[model samples]
Target: SLANAEKSQLEKELEAEKEEVETLRDNLRNRDKMMKDRIAMEESNRQEAERRMGGMSKKQMQSMEERAKSAEEEVEKSRKLVAEMRMAYTVALVQSRFLRKAMEKLNLITGVTKTENQSLSLRLSNAQKDLNKMEEETLNLKEELAKTKEKVAEAEEKVTHMKELVETMEEGIEER
Candidate 1:
C-alpha cells in the first residue's frame, strides 16, 4: 500500500513538473514577444524624430542632433535588451527540451511498470486457478479413499463370516 501511494505521488509530481515547465515556456515566449514589440516601437519613434529634424534651422538642427544622439543611445539600449531577451529565449527553449525528454523517460518507465503489473496479475490468476483445481482434485481423492475404506471393511467382514462357516463345517464332520 505504501508503494502504491508513493507511485501515485510520483505521478502527481511528474504532472506538476510538466505543467510548471510549460508555464515557464509560455512566460518566456510572452517576454520575447513583448521585447520585440518594444524594439519595433523604438524604431518607429526614431524614424519620426528624424523626419521632424529635416525642416529645422541651424540652431534647431544642433539641438535636434543632440536629441537624435539621445535617441540613438536609447535605441542601443533597446537593442541590448532585445539581445538579452533572445538569450533568455534560447535558454528557455533548451530547458523545455530537457524537460520534454525527462517526461518521455517517465512515460516509458510508467508503461513498463504497467506491463509488468499486468503480467504479474496474470501469473497470480493462473496460480489461483491451479490451486482451485488441486483443491477439487483433493476432494475427489478423499471421497474415493472413503469408498475404498468402506469396501475394505466389507471384505474383512466377509472373510470373518467365511472363517466361522468353515469352523462349523469342520466341527460337524468331527462329531460324525
Candidate 2:
C-alpha cells in the first residue's frame, strides 16, 4: 500500500511536469509563428510605403521613414523576446529531465527501504520467538530446582532420625 501510494504521487508529479513542458513548447511555437508573421507584414508595409512615396512631399517622406524605423525596432524587440523564451524553454527541459531522474532514484530508494523494513520485521519476529522459548525453558528449570530442593529436605529429615536411633542404642548398651 505504501508503494502504491508513493508510485501514484510520483506519477501525478511526472504528469504535471510533462504538461508544463508541453505548454511551454506550444507557447514557444505560437510566439515564433507570430513573430515571423509580424516580420513579413512589416516588410510588406515598407514596400507599399516606398511605392507611395514617389509622389509624396518631403515631410511625408520623413514621417514614412520614421514609421518604418519604429516597425523595425518593434521587430527587433520581438526577436529578443523570442530568444529569451527559447532559453527559458531549454532550461525547463533540462529541469524536467533532472526531475525525472530524481524521481526514478527516489522510487528505487523507496523500494529498497520497504524491503529492508520487511526483513527487519521478520528478524524481530524470530527474536521474539527465541525469547519466548528461553522464557519457557527458564520456567521448567525453576520447577525442577524446586522439586530437587524438596527431595533434599526429605533426605535430611531421614538422616536426622537415623542419628537419633544410633544415640539411643549406645545409651542402652552402656546401661547393660
Per-residue CA lDDT of candidate 2, range 37-106, in tens? 6556655655665466335555654554465455545545554554555455455555545545555564
Model 2 bad stretches (over 4 Å): 1-6, 112-176
Q: Per-residue alpha-carbon lDDT of model 1 for 1-176, expressed as tens digits?
A: 54444444544544454454445445544544554454455446445544653344456444434544554454455445445534544544454445444444434454346776675456445544544443444344334434433433443343344344434444544555
Worst 10 residues of 1 by lDDT: 147-156
At residue 14, give the lDDT of candidate 1.
42
* Clash count per candidate: 0, 0
User: In model 1, which regions exceed 4 Å deviation?
Assistant: 55-116, 119-176
lDDT of each: 0.46, 0.50
Residue-pair clashes, model 2: 0
**What's model 2's lDDT at 58?**
51
